[model samples]
Target: MIKPLSMIIFGQDAEQRSLTRMQLISGGKVNVVAESSDYAHGLDLVKRYNPDSALLITNGKSEASLDLAKQLAKEHPSTVIVCTGTNCLTETVIKFFRAGASEFLMQPPSQAEMKEVLEKIVAARATADQNKQGEAVIACYSYRGGSGSTTLSVNLAATLAHTFEKPTTIVDLNLQQGTAPIFLGVKPVYSIADVAHNQDRLDAQLLKSFHTPVSDNLYCLASPLKVEEADDVEPSHIELLLSLLRGQFAYVIVDCQHFIDATTVAALQQADTILLVTLLDMASIYTTKRTLEIFHKMGLGDDKVRIVVNRYVKDPDVPLDKVEQVFGHRIHLMLADDYRAALSALNLGSPLVSSQPKSPLVKQYIELAHKITGREATPKKGWKGGFSFFGK
Candidate 1:
């Protein structure tokens, strides 16, 4: 059985406050956590109890009632505020609701009316809890520049957005010379530099203005258009920008720069899962092993680091076991090598998953998305690439 809705009540009229408390307690669904005659004391009680609902009762004309309600709503969005007063005119009620009152009641509320109001608040809480979920930060990086990190980042983002139909944004953390926007064929007017500049006023709506929309669910916050603009974005700016984006987006895919600079380190620290993309070649493999050591030093656990072998082919030269032994972690995902198909998509300024939907390379990209999101994406019918049969 679910516990009762915890509540705090504040009223000027002691008789009215006592009556309301009696009604709420009788219902057996509302737990009166705290009660106060002073509005200021009530605010303190609210902070202490962290109740689900706050009942603010206005006796005659206490301006503090509305002020307290507004502050509570702003500070604790989870708490529902119900305003009840004798001067509850339609215009006054509208004003109270605008001040963040979930429900407004006349001075003398009957037992049934109080019960109904509490029921409504309880129901709304349940719905909100069901919808609330933590945002995912998928940061893709590579020790070597040519390991196809950006390719994997963009495609993984597109696949997550298209398959799950959730709001996704790709942050081009390759502040200088980042080509994530180029792969999507998007020219963003506002980039990460703008976010850094406007960090003081950065909110969901303001951040939305900086993104270049690719589709209904997918957006891109491109890198600085000018190389010098990248200098303006500091590690602190990257951390604040990503923290704001995480609240608004269901998935924030960070296309990280190859270098282990301050900005890149900031991204790695915030990521829910870091996709370490690498190729099977000697140079890429050796660099990745070194990178893993650095990750260990930084206290990044193996669970948070997912090694993705890009352009993978099961060649005898670099066996799978040897690669895992070097990295000290299993390869979480392997993307197939289809040079012609991949190059065509890159040239066309589109993600491979959308450009070549039926290709096996796209299928593997979808599977990689599944591995990250734990959601299976339906594979579309299409021509397998030339190397699909021979590819891993």
Candidate 2:
């Protein structure tokens, strides 16, 4: 049995609103969660309830109805908009669609037509949920600075974009001091702050406009340009932005801030895989342990949170087995220590995957990307071993 669609009705005329609600609820195909004759109150109810559909009755005020439809489509993309009006002219229907209405029904809507629309919405939502399950959101996070989370995020995004040949975006969540744009060698005209500020009017097209194109398939949603702008961002905004991006991009990579905050927690919670990056030093290990405890408290387990050791060297003092024994969890991956190559790439303002493809560090990144995608890493020619698996 299909789940009944939740809907909200908005109309200036109380009589029309009541009639529409009655028809919608007759067959039990639609559940009228709220009904409002006032536009402001209707908008508030939609935000509060976040219903599956919004039914706008265009009685005397067509312009106002269209405006409401447009606003709802931009702010709540998941909610399907259906407009009913007396004037079902060609131009009138076109205007509704342009304003983001999915379906148009004449005044005194038929139960059959409304039922058809509800069925379509349910089927469409099912397909969208399946697609979302296939998409991946990978977040690179650390509790201490200089753990190289940003570098890992940028290079991994680049490799995923190149390997999959699909659209991939790396979001810089280190609002105050984000450098993902610098690492990618692009100066973005807009930042995540812009997205938050204009969230009321944000849609897929508007979001694409804000992205700074790094490559054919790679894009960057930069951090705030001014440090003060970071204050304007909220956890709710991060959640909304990521949800929208998930629908548009094949992969979303988030470079989270070093410290734990509400905003960072928001991103971590949304991620399908959280790469807990850290160094092999005792201090860094302790910080990572604390972070793991916090994550455990947050209901994130070892399955979602994978520890990655960056800038790793084969130090006898800090053996991999001992670190695993201490944490009671295995380290997921270890990136080789290559200060010269990393510094050179930074100077060139490019990821090592692109600046120095032959570097071993780049191969490890490729391997990591392949592992995330559940594919075997391709072996490089002239190398005795295919690819080193330090995690093994």
Candidate 3:
């Protein structure tokens, strides 16, 4: 049985607060931990209780409620901020979403509406708890450039999020040429450097707010916006950031830089699984061998580091067996070669799963995610029709 959702109510109307509390309690799915008419006191209650959800009542005219909601969201990222108001204007809903509110409801919401919201929160919590044993950190690295490490990192994270319904984050460690933000089509206001500068005060909640949300379950922590800002980030910052991300997300995917550096080493050390991405060519094979040797020196076993050959063709000049023989390690996975599909997705500023769900490349990514998570694949809705090159 699911436990009742712990909630706190903050509103200026005492009568409205009481009514809301009674309504929630009648459903037997919400336990109102605290309620206050005073915004400051209610905010204090939220911080104290750290409830599952916070319901802010607004009457459209007051900025006080909105301000309280924003503060709660920033300070308590784990808590679901639900904005309830009589004014359901499109602009009002958009404003709350921009303020970081997760859900919105009409004032004195009906029993059915309230129940639906509570169920959504409970379901999300249950999914999170399912993976609470420990977070899995998967770092994608490539010793040679143009091996599609970034592309793999982005799509793999997206597959885990959209297909597997897992909470996942992708960190862009390619500091100088990071294109994660562009791939996800988001203009981030904060970057890894910003988080590093505030590392002393960083917590899971603060770190959660720093990332840009790519979808409901996926987020991206972009590299430094300015080229020189990369210098501000140190190896220790990467370690601290990964630690906090593990606490908040089920899976953390790091797009490591091509060359070995202090920062990349820090990320690799924390990774539970390392995907050494390479292409099916002699150059990539030679680099993979050297990289494997380095991993052995770093005490990362072959079991921990998996080789993934990207842009694989049907009959490569260098056969799979010969490549595996050179590295003395089996190629864990080989993704299909579809340059047009990949380039189209990149140009569209979207993940392959979103832009070309039916593409063989997307299917391979789904298989990769299943291999990582050890979960069975479920068929996605609206995916039985003819294939289209673009999502349009």
Candidate 4:
């Protein structure tokens, strides 16, 4: 049986506040670990219980609701913040949702409607476990520069590791400024340059000597971090090193440089899922089209490559279907427009999944993991990775 989750609710409204808590408790949506009428006092309850879900159930218009959700997302990191009010306005609801409200319930929802929302949260949570168990790998790269490829790679890698609690490793093959270590807060004594210099001695013991552990199950291959030493490493050296690594881990993520070089090709050949990321602009979309054409020309199957549109906003500047028409391929993944929040998470050295799990952008990456691995990823109560079957 699944245990109930911790939840926090904030409001000055009396009746509406109690009603929201009652519904969650009745349906087993949460354990109701903490409850407080005082907004300031609620922060202690939140920190004490460490709820996975929170609701701001104030009576009328209150800017405090908006401020609370933002703080919870920043401070709690893993908590899912939500807002519900009787006098909810369209603009206010939209603003709160944009402020990271996971689910919004209007005043006086029927028991069934409330049930449905809670169920969706539960179902999504259930899949989170299977995603941790399956053969999940997300290889992120770009067709051109400044397309936010490395940003995606760094965050997704850290997300898979810390958010899902899976064993994750990122191989930084960007000979110049391999950004994984910097984003992940890892430091390495040696790199692909050193790995190549001693490929003859590359084994579990030898490889362990050169790598840096970012978290319990997460590791990073810091690039040389200096341009002068990059020329010493070759594509073949990276290929050999990664081939050995693939056998040791469940997911092998390679942040391949934006090049059609021998190294990138070798990594692609070994990759189970390749993310061909591009922005929505004309030039970036054209690069994606060219990549598809080149892949076809090289006799490579399209099944392995996933076209992802990064930094996608619901704007009329370019229809997503038209972008597909240009590439003549459907975009499998469309990351949201939370580039600022995503960057803040990256800048703080914590991945988006941990910093903002319920953010639309994090949800996209979570969904992509489910599709790539063909397993559902719902949020889990205990362990947070590919599958719960491991370590038994």
Candidate 5:
């Protein structure tokens, strides 16, 4: 089946706009959403129409055209961009490509060239949609509070997005006292209850509406604002909600409450990796051992259950070797204690990975992301300085 292509034309020349519109229409599969006279207006058109592709005219010495293309590509990576101009110089084509334009056409493009470009865009979109359908789900749980499971969940999701550049989401399943949203500094207008209420009519767009953006690539599905609201969420709702989210995001990190309930059980069953967070304390260790036994009875193996030691130090009340022997499972990940950094992030309503990018905590999360993604984590130049909190 032939897919329809939505396009917006950008050019100052009336004659050029007319020619391009005529050529696009002649292709019989393109729909012109809007026309712009300059790069600024073209950006406004893109924001309004959200077409499948934006056709930019880089005539003369319009360096601003390349800037606009780069901005659109970075901000809206899903949109395809094509550039056309009288200057088909190899240097000009290279610039357009670097600016994120997928295809370039000469002035008054032939019908064959237009058709070929549209087909390429459509085929690429189809393949991307197919590949992004299944997402990895990571669930973080602890038998005791203050084990830092929620903090791990939030930073792990952010690291997966910032480091791996994949679309990631964190779900707060601790309904009553969930702090995932607070950590991200987002007061969501809608919560998971809203999704449960509208489950019958839920779709990708509707599910996404409940997600509040934590960053360009990370989002959060916050817990219920009112504790009582969690009562309305059913275990089946959790299963369905995760299924829907898996289709939309590349990674879904779930922060579960301390106690295991119907909702948490459902989440654990769906998780690709169940992170059991503990501390170097007797209480935390004892609880973790019991939790692992429960997982065993539930038919989960060592591969599925990953033991994480949070707030670990070289010397502790309970030694690492002793803890491992007691649990009978090697710790898969260890996060160093940074009380000052953790306190600042909690107080500032931002994640440590974003707030204290230079903090060693951020590297721990990055390493965890690498472990989960099976990808290598490389440090950037001056990365030791860390990143500013989204320019905060």
Candidate 6:
């Protein structure tokens, strides 16, 4: 069950070079049917075909090849890259790896070497697809304070990363009062403050350097501990940051500020779904009402927002119907009361979702995540087709 691999090449001689390269790659059994020649054209091909690998003949001293490789790698992190060039100097080889090349074949490479390189890059593609399938995003936001937004965001991000073998980031955009690092018990050398201060210098490599990895796949960019030491991050800054993050993590969950500031608004717009968390109380309900009204004006519809009743009870002073009636909307999800356990989990820097996946609370979140992703409401149920083997 072998799938045809998509391949792209760099420069004007794309057709001739890529075709010849494809001959070696196909080995007649495997199809190296897809190819692209130049950097701009390669981007279009990669976006359209989603190539498994891009075989680059590194243009003699210029970084045209390296630059193209970096762009493709960022878009399709799983897409392997193989470089063929005489200029495979020590520094240049390091650059290729940094740009996400799986293997580099020097100019006048051997048939055995080419075959070996092709196999390695293709194998990497298979591994990457498997990893991508297992990823999911958990978004943590609140309708009001004291409903435990920070606690939930920190724990939830950690849960996905540590428990599921998925890469996750706990982004603390609370900005002024964010407590993400405090909860995770980590002291990041650079925080969102630095990112804001150095927006012009923000790039893939620098952003990676700023992230404090909480676990193998779990990382965090906590808030600036000092509230005032900041430049007001613009909407563009947030847009660029989140766009970059979509590629880096299986889940990019932010502990969002309750208010719709420039940053929060940007986050909400880009979110796959928004979990509007609240407890069954008057103050929260009132605040939720105001926020929804504001969102309505901005056109963030009901379809995008999921109301989560955190710390809920079967019966409460405020009934679900009455509460919904007040807001003129239905209650979408409910998590049972477990204040002590939630607090303990937050304090210990462990997420209830991971430690207690089957807990009523955890189950509710899992269900919501499934629904948001358009996966089956039933958890084990998967994508429409049965998992593909080789020739789908």
Q: What are the models' TM-scores? A: 0.67, 0.68, 0.65, 0.61, 0.63, 0.61
Highest TM-score: which candidate?
2
| Candidate 3 C-alpha lDDT tens digits along 1-392 | 23467788888788988999999899777878668777755565665455788888887334777778788888878788888999888998888888889888888889899888888899887786565543589999999879999999998988888876779999999999898777666677789989878865666677777898877688899999999999999987886687567667889999999999999988887687899999877788888999999988977777778899899886756788888899999999999999898888777667888778778998899888878878766635422112223443
CA error at residue 243 for candidate 2, angstroms:
0.8
lDDT of 2 by residue, 190-267 (tens): 999998898766667787888998876889999999999999999877876876687678899999998889999888
lDDT of 4 by residue, 20-95 (tens): 7788788754656446667655554565444567778756436766777777777765567767776677887787
Q: Tell me the whole-model lDDT of each prediction, alpha carbons only.
A: 0.80, 0.82, 0.82, 0.69, 0.80, 0.66
lDDT of 3 at 365: 92
lDDT of 1 by residue, 121-231 (tens): 889867864464434788999988888999888888877777777899999999888988777776679899998888656656777899998876889999998899999
- State the lDDT at 114 in candidate 1: 84
lDDT of 2: 0.82
The candidate, 2 or 4, that scores higher on lDDT is: 2
| Cα error, candidate 3, residue 129 (Å) | 12
Model 2 alpha-carbon miss at residue 55, Å: 11
Pick the winner on TM-score between candidates 2 and 4: 2
What candidate 1 gets wrong by more than 4 Å, as runs, is: 1-135, 379-392
State the local distance difference test value for candidate 4.
0.69
* Residue 294 error, candidate 5, Å: 1.0
Candidate 6 wrong stretches, greater than 4 Å = 1-139, 353-360, 373-392
